[model samples]
Target: MSTKFPEIQGGGSLILAWQIKGKEVLVVAAGRIVNLLNADAKVTVVCPRNGLNEEVAYRVNNGQVKHVDRVFLPVDLEPEKKVAMVLTAIDDPDASTRIWKYCKQMKVPANIADVPSECDFYFGSVHRDGPLQIMVSTNGNGPRLAAAIRRQIGQMLPEGTGDSVKRVGQLRRKLRKVASGKTSRDISKRMAWMSEVCDKWSTDDFNDMDDEDMDKLVRYYESGEVPSFEEIRLGSRDHVVWEFDGTFGWM
Candidate 1:
């Protein structure tokens, strides 16, 4: 007997974080312009002055984004501009469809807000804290449900989780510097050590670590020694007086 379940159709959208930094993005209307701006996209909103909501107006006035002060024309998608993507939230379905066709012809990605079929991608409800970002998507089924789930997940995450992530990143960079020129086996060992540290250490333990503690951890990596959590927290390796100059070694 075949063990495979019956196939389900639809919902095959791939979730991704598009890197639009410093790239031109043509926004047909003002509704989703803020999201584009937040991603560091060089946004140019092609909408009437009256169409702009308060927030968008503020951004335009502040010179955060360029404003065209007119409705979107097919000319806006001219090849020389090299638009990375397009986002439209206009009320006119015909105009939106026209823009979508132009985007397709130009091979540019687009999101036509509320019209999932026309969108090449859907925006997720994002929860951000410093370097840590969690995005929840419903694959264009129910945005509200996705937002609710994101809220619950955010509430469950421990406080200072972002700080812990930043700390771990610093530790990883330090370990790489200390383990420089080591063999492939040694590199694998260092990776294993980092994995162990992440598994064994709590968020509180990472948040509690300061620069001095990080230095000691690097020393442990250099010597192929692993210290207990309590030993690291209590500065048991303080007497060794470790310092990183060129590479981490006994000084």
Candidate 2:
């Protein structure tokens, strides 16, 4: 007999702590979620053959992940390895709920693609800087809105932000004493100056900064307790906190 379950009016979510890198992960999606993420971690995609064969599977075929022609069945994938995260993008609530229960039993973190309330962790619209990364997410409820914001942020960034950060990272690693914190604050300050410089740099400024100027900038970052904002040469430290507006009436 089909009994109706009341739909929860508002959404709730949790961010479970589990790093999927080199760990088993099961993805159950008929959509593009798996394709886009390229199955991070030791990933496997299980979906109906027709829908799963899209670009996502193509990428997976490059030794990114293994694929099984099936729907979501927790028993099929041995979660004993404590697979890191299971992603489900299906529209079926029961299927999503079942996947959630399976993760709990296996002690694995799970994220049901579009279902944040049933997830352990939520994905972010990322802004990466090698080891320095900035991520923004709205718990998966509003990915379109999140994506729009991400585009706006892209425009705000200076040209060659990636190149600039990469250069900074190489320098930071080379200074052994600084890497070990002998000059941690100094290196941090230099990084700050670099950010300011990058932010306000004119087309000519970027083209003209010589080896001497770059060295001076590094010294400025390392030599000071206070990094002036005018010299911020890298990225923004600003953050957007995600919080739910509490207005729920229990069913």
Runs in model 1 lying further than 4 Å from the true structure: 1-10, 180-191, 222-226, 235-251
Cα lDDT of all candidates, in order?
0.86, 0.61
Supply the TM-score for candidate 1: 0.82
What is residue 20's positional error in candidate 1, in angstroms?
Answer: 2.1
What's model 1's overall lDDT?
0.86
User: TM-score, each model?
Assistant: 0.82, 0.61
lDDT of 2 by residue, 163-230 (tens): 65665555445443333554777657556654565556554454444454455444544554323333
**Candidate 1 minimal-lDDT segment of 10 residues:** 233-242
RMSD score of candidate 1 (Å) = 8.0
Q: Which candidate's TM-score is highest?
A: 1
